[model samples]
Target: MSLRRWGAVLAGAALVAGAAVTPALAADPVAPKVTVAPATGLDPAGTKIVVKGTGFDPAANDGKGFGLRVGPAKADVRDRAGKDFQVSRLIKKGAVGSQIPLDDNGNWEYSVTVKAEYVASGTTYSAKKQPFSVFVFGWDTPVLTWDSTTPLKFTEAGDAATGLAWGLRHSWRNYVTRGGGTVTPSNGATLDTAAPNVEPYPYKWKYESSGEGTVSYTGQVTYTFEAHTIWDFTIADPRITFGGDGAGTLTAKVGYAFYGTKTAPEKVRTPSDVVLADLKLKAPAQAGDNVAVDIESAKLTAAGAAAFADFYKPGEALDTGRLVFPGKSGPAPTSSTVPTSSAPPTTTTSSSAPCVLTPDSVKQGNLLWGFKQSFRRYVGIGSGTSITASDGVEITDIDKIDGTGPPSGAYLWGFDSVQYKSATEFTTQFRGKVTFAYPAHSFELSIGRPKVVVAQGKGKLFADVELKTTSGAPSPPISQPGVELASLDLAAAKTTEGAGALSVAGIKVTLGNAEAFAKFYKVGEVLDEATVSLGASCAHLPGPGASGPGAGPGVSDDLVPDVKYRPDSALASTGADSGMWLLWGLVLVGAGLALVLVVRRRPAPGQRP
Candidate 1:
């Protein structure tokens, strides 16, 4: 339907080699036809169609009754009047147009008025998509296009007055007032991509493979100025890309202060990702999927004229442009004010896909537990007790049902990494760091990396905590990092596939958070009992991990390879293999294989992960 459809590649609408129209007179050779009924949504005082032509010939053009407008889509209009209408009317033969009476077997119904500028006041659009045809002209016979069938959309307006306007480089806006500096734009993300960009901001997209030859624009623009401190430079966020014929690219985040040599030793240099300006789309204007660009002069590709010192050369004509694109992913601007690596957009994959279990469907795994027993005996009772357990954490008694019966302080944590979400859902990560010192009650606690995320049955128990309290209790010691500690249940469990291993136990653990991870513990209480157990493909799911105490160089879950454990055992070592994304997340937890998970929040620690 006509809500949007572009691909002309370069402005000229006709596209796809003139929609269709052959056999000038083969009788019913698809006889002259045209239909537009409720094309689609069209609101704002628009929508009243009925074009119903069938086998025309009431003297053909000698009849001068055709050319109904709303262009693009199966293209090919062979224009003649209505100044190439972007919305017109001309069913001529009496009032010069609009005289639908016909019935000499030429049959005609023709009502009309599908305008409102063909709708599109705001729905962030312009990655090129203005296609929407409905014609029945015959400039010398050969016309009939109504967009296949019922597909003329447009009824969801409400936010498009401030849609990006950009004036970013006319020599950097005439050198920002002769280099005194000032071009700030914030929160409404990139503040409209800077430079007196003026009332402009309403764009957002998700079609990167979202369809068509590449489309990405999250937007951010900055270009500070200065004189001979060597032009104190500062090129803020900018990473816009458009590739489909007229080609384009711009990457930013440069920093500068330069002066003393030794290869310009640090005075400031640290903003990375150059490759600034190199676009070339002289005159674009699609509207609704966005794209208002006008690269009137842009050049400077050698990584953007090597950040300026040589004064422009890589292709010479640097910037006289204006871009408007479909940027601004919605009234979205609250993630504590969007600082997402300044503007990182380019990810689209999800069409049901996700069921994986691969990595040899997890050979061996381990996560056993015992996080509480009177708080591990009041932090090992004073005397400045110290209970450290590096990377592959350990200080176990292997569940003698801990309750403080005999050194059963419990705390296994190993499974390097696993978040297989779906194929029965998952979230099993564990690296270990237990440390519980007692500098004589100044109080300290640690819980390094631990995730448990089951699915259907139930699960939850994130980690990465480190508290240290003293001064006046009631909430002091906190070093936070994904805390959500405990809430699992995994009811009536069942999973016993073994050539060597794969068991499932009576899962149930409470305590959602008490001063964020057991201070005195009591929020539905009940803590003690957890077990995962894996072997090979699971451990090397990635590599080079465990970087706190004792660090890297590990892989001992009882010499991995074709897992198989019980009554407990696999003592220590779960460090290496942690970045082939556990081998593409176990090839997307294989099982009819699919991806793009659900329960968000897990990419940010260096995010984009």
Candidate 2:
């Protein structure tokens, strides 16, 4: 073979060998393994991030001295927005190496590419590049919603128009803000007539009349008003009705809001202070035209106030007052001087309906201690004339109807009203005269400082005994006197004869810290942003050591997780009436009567008697 041919064969073999071994030669240098610590997660935006790992260049100085690159030969490391990566921390590297600081959001591909070359003799070689990837999540704000079911109504007897007008007028004060104005009702606005709307907040409702044919009639009919919010919260259910034909019955439910945050359920505080006022009720048909029905009784109560207050401020207390009804036997004499054996059985017969004891009969073994009486007439005119009396009185031994105890010490004010020495104190007393048609004995009593109690049957009607202070002066209304009882001060100018009425079942008042009322409820605690923000600045301290590329991994970067909490509005309802299962004894009675008739007409089995 020729020498030239031999050389060509050898060269060709060498080229083939080099091609086969290319991958091995280019393979990464098997230097000491440098495992980068995982990248700690990032927050919403504009924040610093750290990357911890072992085997970083130890000699690199701070910020400018050493930094991080996302990936390979990519000349400049830039964020998608074209911003250069910023190095914020640096630490001395050791067995447990330093981290690379970054400022960007999204997937990041990194490689430790050094600009300086490690020179040996006349040759120079750059540090081998290592690549890795990390993910950054975008921040999102949370949203929340709320909702509830509620029933509402209003009741006043005698005149339907009068009751309707009074109800429509007073419903506006359902939700009061810092100002005296209602949050939903707006300034000087009336409820929407078509579909009653308080506005802004989302409340919708309707009203109806209990015609003669209806078996169960709320006295004098009723105008139901419903209120709700866009968040699906029910502000109120106005079933507050008066029983007429015989006994009056009414029911109600209300929904409201509480403090809340972006991610928390709505926290409901106390119900926007509720009240009934300006009850100008016309007299019954029998009363001469233009003769207005005077307030027979006026009452204020706080039985449920504590329950509502606790819902607003968990440990907060509420202010409240009691209800008063005049001519209603004062506290049903617990101790009697009259002998039971010699006393005549008080026959209580009424032309309208049978005298049924209010609050149902109390059960004591097989014996219930309760009695029913009719509003009897005083036959003597001025203690001498025989006049028929229509204003009868029914007395019950239920202590639940008595006046409330002393005002709560925790209230904004400790009293319901102020005593007056003269009508001059308030512009005037008995500004409006109250008259009754049937039991016509009209002698003016000092209407000042009267112990007022409204009857449960009258819609917003209140009754009080005209008691002159020892100084022979008139009493001031809660507003002028600063009593603010019943939270009715706002509507004082709109005062009328009767407001909304409710069935009297003898409310049981349990007084205590408002928190006791929340015992039945399981609600989540809510914190204002101000409270949480303060925690962020809870004295930051310098970590034990520095951190970042070229620095050693140490305890400094171990930060506790941040927390965001809010109150839970989705808690289950635990109020007394929230889950009340009312047993309509009247309805049952009607059903029983029908069954008795059915059986009476039934033919004897096979023998058609």
lDDT value for candidate 1?
0.45
lDDT of 1 by residue, 1-609 (tens): 221222223223434467442322233334566666646544323344556766565666676455554544333344442223333343433221012345566666654334334222223221126544565555334544322233455544421221223333445545564566555454223432112111122122222111132233333444444343443555544544555455666555666665554345346666677876777654454434433445444567786777654566687764343444343333222223122222223211111111123554553355656665445554454353676666665554333222332243566565666655343566667777787765434556787777888888788888888877654333466777878877887674444333223334445667787767434544666665465554333122211111111111121111111112122222211111122111111013455434332222233353221
Q: How well is each residue in 251-369 modelled by candidate 2, as lDDT tens digits?
A: 23334443353235364533332432111112222111111122222222242333233323322221111111111122211122111122111111001111111122110000001
TM for every model, in the order presented, reads: 0.21, 0.17
**TM-score, structure 1 vs. true:** 0.21
Worst ten-residue run, lDDT, model 2?
A: 527-536
Q: Whole-model Cα lDDT per candidate?
A: 0.45, 0.20
What overall lDDT, based on C-alpha atoms, would model 2 receive against the true structure? 0.20
Worst 10 residues of 1 by lDDT: 542-551
RMSD of candidate 1 to the truth, in angstroms, is 30.6
TM-score of 2: 0.17
